[model samples]
Target: MGKLACFCILFFNVQLGLCMAPDLSILIVTYNSRRDIEKCLASLRDNSRGARVEIIVCDNASSDGTANFIAQHFPAVNLIRSAHNLGFGRANNLAAQHAHGRFFLLLNPDTWVEEDLAAAIVNFLDTHPEAGGCTPQHLNPDGTIQVGAIRELPTVESLFYQKTGLAYVFPRSRRFGRYCMTWWDHDEVREVEQAGACLALRREVFQQVGGFDESYFMYFEDVELCHAVRAAGYKIFSLSYARVYHIGGQSAKQAVSKNFIEFYRSMCHYFRKHYGAAGVWPVKIIIAVSELLMLLVLTLALPFSKLLPPPQAWSSRWTQWRGHARLLREVWTF
Candidate 1:
């Protein structure tokens, strides 16, 4: 049948008695997330407003016995325990493959939802046909707007600002803060390039993108996926209504060094993938030189000690810097 005829037929059919099945699956990839998963799951359960959301938890062989904890406490949760740590991308993909729902929610185990988050997202997608994915507004434990919740695509200037901490100096500047969309008030519905933490998309988009790039391993997978979805002619929306209290760095706290390395490694890979050979070289150089400067700064600050977190352990800060340096080396060689 023709396009108009098909549309009319479906419209009439839906008007008569067409009822679709429940099609929302919340996919959370967990790694040593026991500290936060309970609250996360509880919030989902409490705030779902009786909507049927298939919650799938993918455990990445956490040493902290997170899988057993979930199994013991939340018997209703469908948990997939991997024998070894498959990282975030592959673990999520593993669950996505097993998911029967049409809408996939790539959520973090550290996030606690507000009332009816699933319903709001599903409703948005149902109403706005162009939106390929929607990310909720991020709130910290204290209810402040969370940084790193959403971000713009990488550019030499934005990347440089983000790395050297110039973005903090001009947190409200459109150009300087473009990397994280920090200038926005978090009160409007708008299209965004990337949703760093929580993202919801239909199964068709997931199939078309073939899920996240496994090369990312952890970070920037969302940004890469958002890029692919937009390239496929779909809009990515940031909805202010669906709020999530994000306990950032829940998984990264386990091994700060490893996650630090993966962060830069993924950043380099993302740049290389998005920006071709011509565009990748400058970013590589910027990353190298800027990292060297940061290494020196952090080394000098290591002794002063009172500036950052973990008040007593300056050693931990130094250790993280060492890991970052290793990542810079890997990126430079690549």
Candidate 2:
């Protein structure tokens, strides 16, 4: 269709009330999130002043009653229930299929919204035409501002620092901790490379770059998406004034071992996908070295396990790293 013809069709559709996009479409992909969804929805309802919003929840085959709970309690939600777990990126992409809004907000089901979050973000996007997406300040459950809310794109150097414990050891060093942007307090509105928790993007950004990379499955998908968004000439921002409280890691808390593997696996895939074939090797090597370092520490600590204040911590650490060792072996051979 020609641009004029498409515009006319859209105009007529809106005029006749047949098709009209809301100001914001909130997408939440829930996996066993029945415990968190209610509070999340209630906060959106009570907050989000002066913005037309539609909530869509894609339930990724939750064993818990998440789909049923949304269907019963939140009739307004456009709920799409997948027959199997589609992971984070794919599940959100599935939910976006039903989204009709000027902007799309990717929110976790465990998040609580602040007053007028949607309206404020809508206004910000409206004014800042150059910005393709923005993230509000993320807060922890205890009401402290979350660290690593905004960050630089991950590089091989950053990955090495992160995986080898150098980032944690020298958090204030800009070179060592650049991945987490640890040197700066995240209190100002500025252009950022990635939004860690919640992200809101203009509809056109999706139309250009499409949704999160499905291959990611879970982690680093947002980073890939933001990279694509920026590469497409759209700037992203951290809107520090607006805020959302995140009950982080609700889903990952379910299966720690599986989640850990997926985290590294996705990281490796992300490096390869964006940084080319050679990128995967550095990430794999960093992970392998980290695992080896952990093994060394565990071997030294094994004799003193009983003397540790929490004796169970030593045992859990051993169990955790045992899985990591297996993962490292697989990575090397694969």
How does each model score on TM-score? 0.88, 0.90
* TM-score of predicted structure 2: 0.90
Quote the positional error of residue 1 for candidate 2 in Å: 31
**Tens-place lDDT digits, model 1, residues 1-334:** 6999999998988865424434688999988888899999999888886455888999999888899999999998899999998978899999998786768989999889768898888888889988888889989999998986887777878988886788999999998899888899989999988876689999899889889888878887888888889889988898987898887876776676777677777777888887776777888888788778878877877887666565232247767577657866877765
- For every model shown, the clashing-pair count is 0, 0
TM-score winner among the candidates?
2
Q: What are the lDDT scores of the predictions, listed in order?
A: 0.83, 0.85
